[model samples]
Target: MPAQPSPAQSAQTQLERGNGPEPSTLDAHRCQEVACGNVLRDLYEGLVTEDAQGRLVPGMAQRWTVSADGRTWRFVLRPGLRWSNGEALDAGQIVASFRRAFAPATAAPFGELFDALDQAQAVQAGRVAPERLGVSAPDPRTVEFRLNRSASLPALLTLPIAFPVYLPAVRRHGAQHTRPGQLVSNGAYTLAAWTPQANLQLRRNPRFHDAAAVAIERVRFHVTEDAAAELQRFAAGDLHITEVVPPQPLVSLRRRFGAQLRLSPYLGAFWLGLNTTRAPFRDAPCAAGATRCDDRALALRRALAMAVDRDKLTRYVTGLGETPAYGTVPPGIAGYTPAQAAWSDLPQAQREAHARALYRYAGYSARNPLTLELRYNTSTPHRRLALAVAAMWRQTLGVQVRLRNEEWKVFVQNRKQRAITQAFRGGWIGDLADARNFLAAFGNDGPLNWTGYDDAGYRERLARADAAATDAARNAWLRAAEQRLLNDHAAIPLYFYTSKHLVSERVRGFQPNALDRHASRWLSLSP
Candidate 1:
């Protein structure tokens, strides 16, 4: 932790941060983007939160304990907790918030995350009412959760979807509860103003429990979808921190900004998601075989996965200090080792030859190459990466590729529906510092499983992993699940992401973490 600057020592009490496009909503349970999570963390405090280094720390809950069986958890809230509106916030409201998030009518995007809770799956499926959820308020200051199976309650609670919402505001204003004037939060900040696709202003919440320790009085998040434009803003001293740096000008930016440029390993994976629910990528039953299978769709997917040169892509197109990912999960997670594809150790030339053979086996050749469309969101880096990938496939496998780009919102919707998406750019940033967060996304019912990979074997492996009682047992199951995913060629892993940003020297307490989470409450603007 860094020393906080006193009001007299700092000339400005507000910090400006560059971010991506506007969040679709400010509701913690509904919003899905990382940028939205960043803002929501400041406005709403979960029972468990992270410190500057992304380690789990106490937030609204002062302390918590789990039962010996690990199926039940209890949390004791801090004294005198209140919403930004100055109304007393009690444990009952917390329970109500959890129920609202899991209600079938709410359709929370990440509702699957709470499947561990007792009756949660049934509640989300409309089989049971939301009131049947496992969470309960034992007393005004105590909230309890009963899980049907063992899970890390602390890690689950740290996610934004687990954060409590103000039910009164929602009841009074409906969907408009998230608007600036109506939004009532309990974190270190309150929504002051918002202009979509432009910027949002957050002022310090005096009603926050730990407001006395907060240093920055205001945080202004400017929408910076264009990395080049964001870089210019940073160079012009208009932003104290940038969301991301353009990869193409890395050499010059590093030379110009020096220590101001921040790059650190991130717990994320950039991958290409092949729509397994559609043609060319869908899998079929394979004949009984010891070491070979005659599945055309499987062959096509493997060929596409092997054709790409991830090392070259990272070196030339990304330019950022990223590792070529052979597996879905990135490195550095504790107690787990990621499994790579079988061809990961093969030479590039040999890999290309194998890919070409597979392509031919899948009924494609120089005379009749497979034609496919690759979709990605409109951005400079995304365009460059798509072009590089297209060129790689064309050169290595003689595949005809078409590139299409859409805005952020439309792109997300299309990807989720998977109706028009053949192959699309997809990535995952870990919500928790756990391997489960990455591998679970490939599960048949995974909330973020946009690839439409529905494998009973894969789902079984994940279930075993989640039910394992010991760490070693759990890790083995996770390893097996990852291997299964890789063998199926469900998605092509390109590179592990590295967090890139430009931080002005005046900003203090902006510690870099693998999770890339930095709250404004801990940051101070120094003179």
Candidate 2:
């Protein structure tokens, strides 16, 4: 094992080397908060990329070919690859890693991506033998994957970051990778030293497939979760890159570092979710009923949606860097050309009236009102938004709303357990640039489907998209699925996310991905 440097020592080393100071990596929270794709881009190489228009382009594997039947995909592994551990890279490891991902009890979060593989679900469910798994490596250099359906299989692997293919030594030790000795990265960089909750140090991997092209020699990540503290540190010129800045700090930084202030629209959406399996939401007729109670509830939701005012929320919470969303799909997503203006153009009165009519058609009256509970993350912004929406519901529909705010982790737990109050918060990052990423969140059986909305018609359309062979045809189904959600009011779009950052002018070659992961491989710090 390499001798690990203490956080202070490592950070000071970077400073002394005139590379500025690297961002904190305290919680391994890189993927959650910052543009982690940049970090991953530095660490791993992949097969394809999403162009500016969100189309897939070739990456590590160059170009691939699919069998005439679309059942088999062949990827010719790049020659002369090596793991950071000094082991020769081969196709066997790739196939082995993917097989493990599909193995029963593994339950890799990305299991769904392999659903197109023949009998993958059955194998994962233990209904079929693992031997029936649909991937094969003909030799140490050739990889082929068999799919149950024909579609853009390569696009699925086109995610910006590598999927962390496991080496035999690392996998043999089991699921823990806490120390430098245990970590064997195949990406552009390898863990040289790590101190949990303090600092993580990465060094250039000479054995990496593209080592010649990697520019950064060493990278350090410090864990700085406190937003205010982070901004203060950055302002003192102690840090090179930072995550989010509160409005106050943003104002100051904008004045001091005008050109350094960077903002990019995020390919994610924040929204509210109603659990449809329970109570008033369970019965289609009751949910659709035109009774005064249902009518009031419907009016209340629409009014709250209008009154919450995303622009105000962003200004207060996100420094007005984010674009307020009117639909589930992000603006630049394929098949989502904004035919009209923003949803803000839809008059509040008309929206409220439409809500009332929807309730009336299902069975409701304006004379009676419905009372419901709303849940939010304990963050001040979410709580404030909840309160504002509640007030609007009361004024517009004469309905009573109770607000419940829980810590962020607790809120996530309740949502997963379906113990949420009447309504709670939800959002999704774009896995792919297609509307399918957004639509996949609504299916009852999906991982992100917090709303418990299960419509046979919607599922039918989703399946069609999954089964689609051509890019154009699949995109059509994707568009239909999103339109279905909008017409049914399945989920309300709060806003499209935009990442705001203050980068030092000295940091060069740092390009941000819409998916919110920062890659350090493509970056270099100047003196």
Q: Candidate 2's residue-wise lDDT over 162-198, tens digit each?
A: 2445546445665455256776666777767755445
Which segments of candidate 2 are over 4 A away from where they belong? 1-43, 47-63, 68-71, 160-164, 167-171, 178-180, 192-199, 248-253, 284-307, 314-319, 338-345, 349-411, 468-473
Q: Tens-digit lDDT track for model 1 on 99-175?
A: 99989877787878776899988998899999999999989999999998888889878777898889888999999
Best by lDDT: 1
lDDT of each: 0.89, 0.62
Residue 332 CA error for candidate 1 (Å)? 0.8
Off by over 4 Å in 1: 1-11, 285-294
What is residue 10's positional error in candidate 1, in angstroms? Answer: 10
Q: What is the alpha-carbon RMSD of candidate 2 to the true structure?
A: 5.5
lDDT of 2 at 391: 70
lDDT, residue 227, model 1 = 84
